[model samples]
Structures are given as structure tokens and as C-alpha cells.
Target: MYKNKYEPALDIYRRTLDNQLKLIHGDHRDIAASLSGISWALGYIGHTEEALEYSMQSLAIQQRCTPSYHPMLAHTLRAI
Candidate 1:
């Protein structure tokens, strides 16, 4: 999705992320990664508000679950 710049990729990312969240348990780092991808896709597709919500969710998860200096958290912070 990030590499190709395709708008339809947002829908695919959204569906996959939703399914991932349902299957994953607890505060998993993989969920955060999925959220970040969804947020990025939303932003690219011009859904700025939804993007921000997902970004915030991803950041919150990272802050709660990952190390303070984790690269994933840093990446999400940059996105926000």
C-alpha cells in the first residue's frame, strides 16, 4: 500500500486490520503495526480525521506496550 500509492489499498488495509484485531489477543505489537498502516492509508486517501484517530490509537498502544524508545513508537509519533 505504501509503495504503490493506490487508493483502493485503503479498503484492503482496513479490512485486514479489522480482522487482525479480532484474531489477536491482548496488547500486541502486531496490532499497533496494523493500526499504523491503516492510519497511513487513511491519510493518503484523504480521510484525515480517521487517520488521526487510528494514529492516536496506534500511539497509545505503543506507549502502553512497547519500550519508551522503541522504533515503532518513534515511527508512529512521526506519523502523528
Candidate 2:
């Protein structure tokens, strides 16, 4: 279930973000996704403001990718 993903996904996002500066940079796509994931994690951990921030970031990317209301973007919004 998605709820279950909250933990591990958050862990991975955190790890990636932590090592991001040293490991890689220049692409906001993955970073945006990571931030969004972290936002969701923060939301799951009870940080709504942060979660909304991440969700909006992801939403921006999703809109650029889809440019319309696709199933994926819909789901992402629903998640928020």
C-alpha cells in the first residue's frame, strides 16, 4: 500500500538528499521528486506545511511532464 511506502520511500529520499550535494547535482527533476517525497514523509510525520510544499513542487513537475490532468497527477494531488 502507499501508506506503507511512506517509511522506506522517505528513507531513500532522505539518503539521496543527504548525499546529493557530493554525489550529484544539476537536475531538478529527481531533486523535486525527492523533495516531494520528503514532504509527504514530513506530512506523514505530521508536518503539513512541509508536505504541502513538497507536494506543490511535485505538482509543478507533474504538470510540466503531463501538462494536463493525467491519472498520475491526479493521484499525486489526491495524495496531498
TM-score of 2: 0.60
Off by over 4 Å in 1: 1-5
Error of 2 at 25 (Å): 7.7
Task: Report RMSD (Å) for each prediction in the order shown.
Answer: 2.2, 3.9
- Candidate 1 TM-score, C-alpha based: 0.84
| Tens digits of lDDT, candidate 1, 1-80 | 35867466777777887898789877888888878888998888788899999999989989899999999998999999
Which candidate comes out best when scored by TM-score? 1
Best by lDDT: 1
Q: Write the per-residue lDDT of candidate 2 for residues 1-80, one digit (tens) a residue.
A: 56556778788888987786456555445565676678878887787987887788777877776646567577677877
Residue 46, model 2: Cα distance from true site in angstroms: 0.6
